[model samples]
Target: MKPHVVAAASLLLIALAATTAGAVTFNATDAASGTAGGQRFDQAVGLAYASQVLSNASTFIWSAFNQTSPADRKPVDAVTLVVADVGGAPAFASGDVITLSAPYVGNYSGDVKTEVTGVLYHEMAHVWQWDGQGQANGGLIEGIADFVRLKAGYAPGHWVKPGQGDRWDQGYDVTAWFLDYCDLLRPGFVAQLNAKMKDGYSDDFFAQILGKSVQQLWQDYKAKYE
Candidate 1:
């Protein structure tokens, strides 16, 4: 098996144990019950479906980070997905609760089901990912979430391809692109990097993991595709 797959299998026992006691449950609430988005969600994506997506996302992210034991991850008992009438951000994750925008749902075009699944995966990472106890870069945090989304095959058509972003930690899809390149250099790089961030973060993480500073790697990554 590949190194990350082997590591993932070894941690499966602990991950399974951590989940068996009903420690992880998901709830979906539509606060915009009468809106077009709510109706669309109900018809195309019901609460049960949303709950299943959230659960799957949790498992995927836990495995992604090699969070095999309780100590390796957060003790999240439950996650709630609320579809509400909101503006600005399409979705946001605060603790274990992910609030998705109803207006965005209503306004979105093409494959709402797939698009929503991607959003859930992105937000779900926040529920489990360590933030270096608030010392991690906010852009890195967001990028990690999108990295999970990218791995899940939900990368939208419009996202910049590999080596296209301006900077390594530019955030969102841009940073996700950079991190994907980093992961390619070392299988399980993302998982290892995330595990190290349980306490705090530093740019040195790139050098420690890949034997190169992030800036150097970014240049090399760009060169590879240019």
Candidate 2:
């Protein structure tokens, strides 16, 4: 296994212990009820985020979206589709809970045990990550969160390899792999960068971390993989 994968696996073992113990509490009634996948998230993420019961599916969507939206994430029934459609690519729709589709969650033909666990960790990172007040590039925002998931030991089986992609900021595993390289080059690079984004993303944040411009960093990152 790659070093990042090994590290992430170790981290997941530790986090899973804590996650299972109800360290993060959320309202249960707020989430989708009677849905198998929804229930899985309720036990895995919702219970971990807050100890409260999710009243129902609509409530769950509202609570997650409202937490992140500059405007209140009004309660809506429309989010049921979101919960059902978050496939291999997980994203926050309308700035609310990180939604993921099933394909992204697991091997289509295999048992979903590992896939769900890994995706949950990744999606949960999005829920908590700071996005530089929309000033940060969306790709970078996603990269950072995936980096956390990479660190947390929940990266998927397919993420075991890195490659040459369109750009370092192509997002998802592509950017995530670049961030892993940065972590190796500069320990705590991802953590420190995340702190910077919390204050509203700025290109200068790159200079602070690596003493290089963002463009320069992207170039270097791309070269490493290419």
Candidate 3:
């Protein structure tokens, strides 16, 4: 979305490199097709819309992460969405696959379409994010995904406001809000951090990019809102 931060080619190059014409195969299935949530997903969300959202979220995530080159992103050939009869979290992403809980979808209040789109945005980020080859903190990885959701303008209402969390790496929306602040301080802060995390992660990365430890940055971030 920040077209001014980088060239249009950077935006176009990486996304188009994921595969042939950036053609990511998307498949969806409802295992609990008889349940209320399954019905909700079918009637409200549907497979076609979910597939489109997947593609769009892919582009948004690439742009949001500042992955302007083929080397900057994961080479994903396909992704799948399965609606299952499960409980707890609404959805989760593993490898190149995503699963949404039918019960959660059935019971959710408010705008179902908008909410699911946000969920898809968050989960899809996991499909493409590096995760330091499984060496990074799980929480930070999740936070980065939420950072993508936030950047896509799909953040939910219940999330903590800016500077309101107990720590910078608290994960989910807390770390997401913190990362958003860091991105403001140094444009492409998340992207640079992610790039550094391709091999591994270090608390020192905060120091490297922002000239201060993450703890110090958190203090400043918290103080700004006081």
Candidate 4:
């Protein structure tokens, strides 16, 4: 081959590599920089640390979902985190953006950085995980996010123990524990469930994956601990 042609091919390869590596970009902003909570965030969880967590959480979520290739994952080009004086929940995810409550950060009495990291992980899971195209159970969606947080080893001390929830889809920690039980029954069950949820959700998904209804599985899980 000609030298110029070889050089052009090399440049093309480099460009492709850069594109692949830059598929997902993370950004963080201290929107509530003037607030006490915002100051706490700056001291304990700066924009750089938050951005890093976003990247790390994305990588972890991909692996947890068994999405080995770009084709298998959601096409999210960017994820942005904003620390602001928000009310209600400590943090929430909307589309690809995550907003952390400044008040929550300021008032938290424990390791704020670690707590924020866990929150980011849960929110990042929402950014990546499919929601049965908006047809899945709300509790299951939240549970899956918490499940990802649980698998990442950041589950908080206050979270409920396995088999303690009133139902399988009670949401948050309760649902997360149940999902963990389901995953144990069939290794990679969570990943499989997430993949199936890409298009839609059905109660029968539990039966299809584990040959048992979700209710029955919940009963069995409770029995083990009871």
Candidate 5:
């Protein structure tokens, strides 16, 4: 058995002690355990911490989305994290599984734990969020995930400043900032928008929820920063 299995078992024990009902199970595994990057992850950000972050990020996402009850959220019962020797992106989520690149964690010069936490929060949002049944704008989906990360106070310094994207749905930090602006105009706008997306996405969602087209909102957001 790998070291992460022990950590995962410990977390399960803690969860069982805390709740007997409706608790989501979280697991973390290091597929690249013998690699240098994987060793760095085990030392700097152990499987225990990674598992805890997964659980924490899920709760934070639920609150961010105003998913007060199971009925208001996705039907995911478990989430898993895999640390491996991947490339390109730092991490990506497929269904309930999140893959974190061990190389990214090892090569990070600043704070790996904090950076990994932010990435986990963003990926966790993907695990719980609706994707408009594959009809939603890809950028919007990514933006919502980053929006959750932003709300959780985990946004990295490298992200674009508020109101700096070319378009509202350009994605990532850009769309997150735009969504933040909309939420300010009407509190819980992101949550409402997410609920609407349970079925499908529409640019008109902005007009329906905030009484203005998305383009106008983008212009207003840009004007504020300019």
Candidate 6:
């Protein structure tokens, strides 16, 4: 009878040990159990997203520039996107990390998955994209990111006609839409433009593809769309 009780206890202890081993581990230093703007995502999915972002960013980098080989690629490491509590803030890019303050990840009945993924893809582009020696137009910088997301087929349903803004590099959805037009009007226009940006962006790069200045191209785009 004593032997039977000891064996049962040993089995229970083993089961508990196995369960503990299977639990997910995180190195969160600031995560609270119940915070106003905190949530947990699938550990595996989050990691996969990070991997995809890096891979795609690498592709964009290599293709967007004249880098002869992987050795010539820019130094990019450790891209992180965080979900935090920020009220009514549109997405913004920071160095190496972009924090998205969501009202709630799953509360929205809309296309939350596409929306989130699209935004992440856009920001990830910014992380890997070169800003043309800090001389690139801010609007164009944003447009390029959106162009990649659009190409990836994650574009949201709300994008409308391009060239509606007062200027060409309006950024975000505005520039994204215009880029789509450029892709249609001039095949591989965005890809070549991306490569130019990778090496130090210049407006003259537009003339290489379109035979006109970026301002002229913007005017043409506006005339066509509007």
Q: Which prediction has the highest lDDT against the true structure?
A: 4
Q: Compared with the true structure, what per-residue lDDT tens digits does model 5 show for residues 148-183?
A: 999999999999999697988899999999999999
lDDT of each: 0.85, 0.52, 0.85, 0.89, 0.88, 0.61
**Model 2: worst 10 consecutive residues (lDDT sum):** 17-26
Superior candidate under TM-score, 1 versus 4 = 4
Per-residue CA lDDT of candidate 1, range 1-226, in tens?
Answer: 9999998776552222112223687877777768988778777777777888898888888889988776677888888888888888989999888999888888889888889999999999988998888999888999999999999989988788877878888898999989988998898999998988998999999999999998999899989998
Off by over 4 Å in 4: 1-22
Tell me the spans in candidate 3 whose CA falls farther than 4 Å from its real position.
1-21
Please report how far candidate 3 places residue 131 from its true position, in Å: 1.0
- Candidate 1, residue 76: Cα displacement in angstroms equals 0.9
Each model's backbone clash number: 0, 33, 0, 0, 0, 3
Write out the backbone clash pairs for model 3.
Answer: none
Specify the poorest-scoring 10-residue window by lDDT in model 5: 13-22
Query: Model 1, residue 182: what's the lDDT?
Result: 90
What TM-score would each prediction reach against the true structure? Answer: 0.89, 0.59, 0.88, 0.90, 0.90, 0.69
Q: Which of candidates 2 and 6 is the stronger one according to lDDT?
A: 6
lDDT of 2 by residue, 65-181 (tens): 233342332222221113343444543433334444533322244435445445544555555556777788888877765665666565777663675566767787778887787
- Which residue segments of model 5 deviate by more than 4 Å? 1-21
Displacement of the residue 223 alpha carbon in candidate 3, Å:
0.5
Query: What's the true lDDT of residue 170 in model 6?
Result: 82
Evaluate model 1: give its lDDT: 0.85
Task: Locate the minimum summed-lDDT window of 10 residues in model 6.
Answer: 17-26
lDDT of 2: 0.52
How well does candidate 2 match the true structure, expressed as C-alpha RMSD? 13.7
Candidate 4 lDDT by residue in tens digits, 70-166: 8998888988888888888999999988999999999999999999999999999999999998999889999999999999999999899887979
Give the runs in model 1 whose Cα sits over 4 Å from its true position: 1-22
Candidate 6 residue 209 Cα shift, in angstroms, is 2.7
Angstrom error at residue 226, model 5: 0.4
